[model samples]
Target: MEQRIQSYDALFELMPEMGAQKELLGCECAQPEYCFTHYLEPGYKEEDILVEICQSVTEKKQDSGQITFKVFLKVSKAACIFYKGSYNTLHKSYAMLLQYIEENGYEICGSIRESYIEGVWNKESEQEWLTEIQIPVGTGSLTQCIC
Candidate 1:
């Protein structure tokens, strides 16, 4: 998560350098979130989980060193789980979402998205932090925000 935060910071700093602008999705400020997928191998450790942080841009930009970009396609349906608390307990929300999906016959088809709605940047207390976990699933309700 810290690494993803660093990537978000780097992306904000490098956007202008790459001649690209952030495409906000109906938000007041730059979208503050770490949208990524973990690449797990049999020999990988918890600390070794590797992910590629992604950010939205107004348009595709030419690659300049580390400014490479890719379009993030949308998911047909997602199990949206909302949690308000500390990062340490964030796993509980994921566990809940997984259990819900399994019991509801929802298949995990794509990468999961972690959106930091409220965090240390805006909130003072860790207990006030808000996170939304979107797990791509097959046809069903468009979105389910089990807060």
Candidate 2:
């Protein structure tokens, strides 16, 4: 596993069903109880934001297969970790990538940015899913709360 820091352009993608939380909350970016994925500004923590966002929407659980809305981060100075594996074993890939990042003196600064480089459910078995685990680097705190 290899980790390299790189900058990225801001992006906004929508998730119909956020895996962690599933409820149709309206689309209000700042709602403390809404359930929509959003693009965090450059210097923010994805995990903290995700928790707050999940709270704003609701605290109810849904069926296992329910599709929930979620968001992906648009990051800069990200430590990129690329790998190929079965979906079930992808966690190992992340662990290895994190180890490599630590060995190289980088810290996980934000929510893990994931990109499916391959295996879109329409590809063959020989082609394992290629994903990039982009963890942000450099920070004073994981979050910058403007209270």
Q: What digit string (tens of lDDT, one per residue) describes model 1 on residues 52-99?
A: 445444456455444446656656678888899987777789889999
lDDT of each: 0.56, 0.45
Residue pairs with backbone atoms closer than 3 Å in model 1 (clashes): none
Report the number of the highest-TM-score candidate. 1
Evaluate residue 127 in candidate 1 and report its C-alpha lDDT on the 0 to 100 scale.
Answer: 92
Candidate 2 residue-wise lDDT, 1-147, digit = tens = 011112221111123234222434333334332231222444334232331122233333343433333443445566677678665565687677777777877665665556555554445772476766666665444453111
Off by over 4 Å in 2: 1-74, 139-147
